[model samples]
Target: MQKKLIDDSFSIVLGKQGLDLAKILDEKKYINEFIIAKKMNLTINQVRNFLYRLFEHGLVSNIRKKDKKKGWYTYFWKIEKINTLEFLDKEIKKRIYNLEHLLKSRETKRFYTCERCNIDYSEENALLNNFICHDCESVLVLKDNTKEINEIKKNIIYLKKELEEVEEEIKKNKDFLLKKREREIKKEKRLKKQAKEKLKKKKINEKKKIKKKTKKIKSIKRK
Candidate 1:
């Protein structure tokens, strides 16, 4: 589900080209741009163009490494998963809001349509024209908005549900990242503790060796 949303968000931002690039991008690690181009069967410039578009939207991030031998810099790209999800969330909310607004308009306002010409007009326009079709010169009938209103309502419901799922996915990803950070911290602490212990043991062993050498010299002088 998360993948689907990510793909959709990419497609929305960068179209089909973005979707193709997104398929090869990594969530955790950065991938070489050349490899991405190869996988997508596109030129490096084409891949960069798509990536730059995503970058403009904060959907992807990049790092550059300079090659001493080649005297050039290469970029690696990774998907910003959380940002992508957030973008999708905002987009879905906007869509839902617009759908609700349209639904309200349909329920409240009157619409007139010319059946022959298949043209529609608002209440004010229809009133100004005396409820007559401007093109077909036929009497304009009041359009039943029930079907349109219901469709808008259904779309709103679907978008709301999708928003809920996106929010949940965002929460889960955040939790997973937090847990991963915690594990990394603990591992670092453990490694530091082990290093300290090893150093302490090494010092103790060195001290013991010095003491043994001193005792040997004293016994030799007494003998």
Candidate 2:
């Protein structure tokens, strides 16, 4: 499901030319940028352009590694899964807002259409055009709100459904991120505790050695 969302996300963002870039990034951590270029069969610069776009969006991250052989720094890249999900969620919410605005306008305002040309125009635009079809030279028809409104309303419903699913994915990704953070926190705590315990044992051993030496010295004095 996550991969599906990732794929869906890239497809949406890249339109007709992109694939599952998130999956490609996720499969290898800190992957060399050149490797991505090779796999995509795109020029290095093209891949860099796309990756930079994702970087600006905060959907991908990178680290630079100096090439031992070439004496130049090269970057490695990976997807920021949580950020990608959040980005998609934000986009969906924006669309939903636009849809709601359209729905309200459709419910409350007037619209006109050119029936013979099957062209749609806003009421203000139609009025500005003098309610005449520019192409057919026919008078504009007062659009019936019933059929088109129903279709728009249905589209709004579908968009809302998709928005909810995107929200759900965001929630799931957030939980995963939180859990990952917690695990790292716990691991650090555990390592710190072990270090403290080791120090405590060393102190105790040192104290024992001191007491044994004092006893031996006192015994030698008494003898």
Candidate 3:
């Protein structure tokens, strides 16, 4: 099994510990729905709805297990890391393309704004309003793109860096799976050895019991 690039279990502090749902789901191979609900401090149905949303995006999968005594089914969830990375890759590509378009617009077109009202207008809107603020009835100032454009460019750069990190995590997951498989194989070998020893011990005990019984019978006959 390969690890996914997106930190499904990745939690980001979105203003005071508000966790990103995608990150939380990405970390576990299989997680119980109830467990997720408890961790998020939400109702089971809320967690189920969120999980279903992720499932629609192909981010998670679930397995249902029936309890023999209770007669109800429990669902266990797992992250689909590969699909998640692909989804993210597609999303980032679209964002980058949009940013490129915005950059071109910033470079080529004139945009105006009302500083007081915090309203922005492109060249067409400004022309329609005769370069005036519609809301505050004030003159529209020529908007500066230097700071805003730079910030957007910076964000694009950061997104690319995050994408690279996700790829690294994917590789890391593959190595982890390989190691786990090896460990399981070793465990199976150990269990087989233990079973053989147990059977050997049982046979020895049986033989001893039979020998003792025969000895008792022969002594009773002599008496």
Ten-residue region with minimum lDDT total, candidate 3: 9-18
Worst 10 residues of 1 by lDDT: 14-23
Output the number of the lDDT-best candidate. Answer: 1
What count of clashes does model 2 give? Answer: 0
Model 3 alpha-carbon drift over 4 Å, by segment: 1-29, 168-223
Q: Model 3, range 130-220, lDDT digits (tens) per residue?
A: 9989998899999998988898889889778766776666567677789999999999999999999999999999999999999999999
The model with the greater TM-score, 1 or 3, is 1
Q: After superposition, how far is residue 129 of candidate 2 from its true place, in Å?
A: 4.4
- The local lDDT score (0 to 100) that residue 158 gets in candidate 3 is 77
Q: Estimate, for each residue in 56-80, the C-alpha lDDT of model 2 and write its tens digit.
A: 8787789998989999988899877
What TM-score, over all chains together, does every model reach? 0.85, 0.86, 0.65
In lDDT terms, how accurate is model 3?
A: 0.74
| Model 2 CA deviation exceeding 4 Å by range | 124-130
Give the whole-model CA lDDT for all candidates, comma-separated: 0.93, 0.80, 0.74
Better of 2 and 3 by TM-score: 2
